[model samples]
Target: MSKKFFEERGDQSAVKAEIIQKYFATWANIILPTAQRYGGGKIAYIDLYAGPGRYKDGAASTPLLVLQKAIENPSLSGALVALFNDMDVNNTQTLQSEIDALLGIEKLKYKPEVNCNAVDHDAEEYFATTKLIPSFTFLDPFGYKGLSLRLVNGVIKDWGCDCVFFFNYNRISLGISNPMVQSHMAALFGDDRAAELRKNVEGVKPALREQMILEELTQALTEMGGKFVLPFRFRNDKGRLTHHLVFVSKSFKGYATMKGIMASASSKADQGVASFAYSPADSSMPLLFELTRPLDDLEGLLKKEYAGRTVSMLDIYESHSVGRPYLSKNYKDVLKKLEDAGDVSVVDPDGKPRRSNSFADRLMVSFPKVKK
Candidate 1:
């Protein structure tokens, strides 16, 4: 609940706002329906850093966007329980007012069975005491102090939950080597590992150090029981590193779904960066991009994974696609290319040549015999 400089400054047209909103909306669009379909009972949406529900220029905030997404998806019409927490009482009140206004609209497309609550409290405290439930919790604190690895691990261990959090890369990079911040960093990472990494990266270039820290953070989350941890970096208008949006999930399916959503939101300007921006006023060609692994890389990776061993397509998909950058389609394409090149042979379970448009789960893949 540390004060965000921007929150006090009251700047509405922040470029990063658009980027965060788009990513949140994309995640909501997919997660809400998926949760409704799979989650047996009511699903919760928790926004830990819930701010005022709109910008001065009328841009919808994350809380409002999440509620709108739930309302739009008829499948989740009455099953959403939203919890909005902000340390600022004024911000909580403002957000509550916005939620009231939206719910009061009589002609709205759908009436949400939403049990919305806005609370003025620290996110860390609230998360620690709340009863565990099937939920998607968003932890977007302005700084890095409020989130601890133990708190997040507890949530995943206690409930069916997925988390999308903002890791303040800028703040962490600046304070990493400072002894004053060592305890905080250790708490955030759940161990003294951050200190060790800080020592190792002491003289590394800023950009390379940032990457190293991010990789270490990803590894930490995975060790804390995250089945998948994907980090998407955001840059400022000056092209400086800003923050990273990190998604942690307990299931491979959830991981794949989040990866696809992130891939779709990637900025076309820099194909390598996953940042994006959207303006309602602009009329231009929509930016579109997809995450793709080079076929050669995929081929080599597949060979390394199953080189001389025979395996099933399902085995490959389950082993490689879920937590990795590549998708199931990438696996299929690479396998097909390998088969065409005579590097591998595709056969049905009975050892007959497989002749199907799509690779079946049970189809066996065999590498070519190596002659002495």
Candidate 2:
């Protein structure tokens, strides 16, 4: 196998890195504390393909950022295990040096009792042998080959483990036709069924074909027992699709936490599919502009499903929250609007019309009856 190359390159930070860092930081901030609060004393973070701790420009990489988050949060000062794995020896050494520097500092506040392990091993082999734990694994590979579907299934088969991976859409699409990598592609999708499906879409439009492949991969994850799968698309400076940050988790809470974080990072207010773009013009700044999708679209969807049906608030939120672009907060807002406009009736447990708009307290929602 080819040695990891990104760290060997002089320039470390790129537009794509900027976009990814924002989402990674957001996710860590939410998940770290939440995991500590509920995980009964132990929490873990595993970064497969962790790079050198900092970019040439001094921007902290994912490993350092995660460590910093743990250090900042006093509540998570319990047993926290952080495993940083990379196949490249230089990358692992660099990360360890950075950690050593942090340890040498005397005055850092809220230092979590971190059991840090830096390993120089292939991510696939590590996952195959390591005993699974309640952890958050970040699988950001340069390409699609190292992260197999079987490994991902094994990681998430138990509870309290969530995965965020870089799905290289451009690379995968370009390589799909190459015969040498066909075995890897088959392993990625967990079977030959997806390969057959891809073969059938030979002449489809480029955009549509990419979407189909994304759907197939996502389906494969869900079939491996993932309760929620979310994909956040990233575009490069020239408006070309780069990679998708795909998240998989068995918990609805994990799904909601990630969805909320992604929504907050988004610049759009429509609360439907969120996308982030990196532009050459704003190289130094965070690019989190929301693409405009009609709010009416969500309203229409809600109406179609909930109209004339009595659905509980939790059920409604759970059903529409994860895997979709919109947030549960947005869904609640739309339901409140429908209630106010006399289109849907929001009720309490006693079946009386709810006086407040809070859906958490409300028991059920009944759409307005159609006039004869």
Q: How much does candidate 2 score in TM-score?
A: 0.80
Give lDDT per model, in order: 0.65, 0.65
Q: How far is candidate 1 from the true structure (C-alpha RMSD, Å)?
A: 6.0
Best by TM-score, which number? 2
Expressed as tens digits, the lDDT of each residue in 262-291 for candidate 2 is 655543344454543223423443343433
Cα deviation in Å at residue 145, candidate 2? 2.5
TM-score of each: 0.77, 0.80
Kindly report which residue stretches of model 1 are placed more than 4 angstroms away from their true locations once superposed.
1-40, 103-131, 237-239, 268-293, 349-357, 360-362, 369-372
Model 2: lDDT to the true structure: 0.65
Candidate 1 per-residue C-alpha lDDT over 215-270 given as tens digits, one digit per residue, 9 for 90 to 100: 78878888888878877666543445667778888877667666666655544323
Off by over 4 Å in 2: 1-40, 103-130, 271-273, 276-293, 350-363, 369-372
How many backbone clashes does every candidate have? Answer: 0, 2
Quality of model 1 by C-alpha lDDT: 0.65
